[model samples]
Target: MSAVLRRSRKSPAKDGPAARRDIPPGMRPPPLEPMRNPGLSRARLLDMHRFLRLNRVLEDQLSALYRQGKIVGGLYSSLGQESISVGTACALEPGDLLAPMIRNIGSLLVRGVPPLSLFLQFLARHAAPTAGKDGTLHFDDPGRSIIGPISVLGTLIPVMTGAALAARMRGESRVALTYIGDGGTSTGDFHEGLNLAAVLGLPLVLVVENNGYAYSTPVDRQFAVDSLAERGPAYGIASESVDGTDVLAVYAATQRAAARGRGGGGPTLLECRAFRRRGHAEHDDMWYVPRDIVAAWEQRDPIDRFESFLVEQGHATKGDLRSVEENLAAELDETARQALGSPYPPPEETLRGVYAGGD
Candidate 1:
């Protein structure tokens, strides 16, 4: 046998006995069991379901705001990529930073940004996170320690790389996570950013959320590789391809990746396999998506997949799931409604933070 194959299969116990051990009634197997491919625990699975459900609630609220004209300008929203946000953010400590993309509403919420502030930002209202400057996108959150949701595509990579470099210099071990789409992977800044992170061994997490499309272009048309996860090794970073819709899978992979970063092991590249259920933006007609293909990926919706996982793993009952969804919806609705009733940013303070290190 080839060396790689032999090493991968040299389990202490035989494949049959070890793999087919009978569990006692309802009890599930332990998580973190070493294998060729690792899986998540029942608890993790339950958490994932809750996270995505909450995400859907938030998305609904945002959609309502847009429909009501309370939300202004472009909304580069993402409804289906909830697992990347929920899974990775859940794994972070209090002080960690998320340098996000335009579609990272879930990441902001999970990182402890107030839902009201998120709504206000969407509305371009005063106290709108960015003080009404940013429209329908969030970035300014001192309370949550989030740096941004840069709208100009891949430019955030270099800025995030610098942030990670600064953290390393300041002796702060907090990990900085930055997202790149499959399309962003080809940008010069992406390469430059990752190259520096790897060389400096910066404590950073680089997540490539491969949702099969970047804007409107499919992965097959953009790249030759099967998974974006393969790019990590080129930068000498430890990496993995996770089932992005399964929040548990994303969480497990991120936890391991973050550990690799903070343990002085440098950066870790993670590819989150997800689907873009919504259009590129509200303005898009989404004519590029084939009807059959959309239907197929939609069937594997992350939130639904996770609910089944919860039931199959015996982590949650139907009532428990319902309660979680109900509570989250109520909370999100309150936040959004309150935002609608709130005041806008003062016109006098319009030019506030353009220049830093001053009052």
Candidate 2:
């Protein structure tokens, strides 16, 4: 057997069977035990159900617009990977910082980016955040503690590390939550950011969404390491792996990591294992992905998985889940309609916000 295969079978501490075996009868095993220190209440679980469905509906609507050629650039959808963003975002406080990637629309929404704003950005209308200057997923609002991501992979790690440093300087008990792809862990900036964060003892939580592809390049071609979280220990940081599809597991791991960060502990590397059910963007046909691989991930679809967990655990009923979905559908429909109706940025206004004038 290959070394990579051997390493893949070795479970991390938090994801081991012992940590996950405490479920009651008829309940499926959790990827990780729910943390009591910051356990999720029934109300919070309902809220999570709402966020998960909200993200799915929004992404589906965007994809529909893309298919209709209304969207300007490539459209990325977080179809199978919604839970990681929603779960992690819910674990954070308002004062914390978040750096969202192309596939992190859920995280942005959870952090309070209105669906109207996202629709406007996608449509490149007059009131779009970048005034149509930016062609893709780039919308930053520092006042809301969210940093818009750049196109470059792995770069946000350093940006988040710096934000954590600044928070420390300001005496804010805040942590910076940043994300990267499995393929992103190969980039030099990933190492540099992590090393610096470790050395400076910066309060940062780095999430690596190991979705098994770097735009058609499989894990075998990306790196020799079996798991991306292995890089954490080398940098003297706390690290673990979680089932990204399991919303509760992701939330529990993130809650622990964020608490440690706020308590003067340095960074943590959380490798979330899941699969991206869509192409790198809407344009790609995903011909390279094997049929069986896609089929397997489909069985563990995050939203479906989480919904079942909620019902089986007696936290919610099927009707409750249905009501949440029904409510979000109306809200999303109204917001998207308004965004489309909004005016486009006038051609003459392109350079208005380019330079900062003396106030």
lDDT of candidate 2 at residue 171, scale 0 to 100 = 89
Candidate 2, poorest ten consecutive residues by summed lDDT: 21-30
Q: Per-residue alpha-carbon lDDT of model 1 for 249-352, expressed as tens digits?
A: 77778888888888999888898877677767765545555545557667666677666666666778788998999999888878877888888877877667
Q: Please give the TM-score that candidate 1 achieves against the real structure.
A: 0.83
lDDT of each: 0.72, 0.82
lDDT of 2 by residue, 226-300 (tens): 677788889999999887888877888998899999998899999888887888888765555555567877878
Q: Which stretches of candidate 1 lie over 4 Å from their true place?
A: 1-48, 356-359
Q: What is the TM-score of each candidate against the true structure?
A: 0.83, 0.88
> What's the C-alpha lDDT at position 325 in model 2?
86
Candidate 1 has an lDDT of 0.72
Clash counts per candidate, in order, are 2, 2
* Candidate 2's TM-score: 0.88
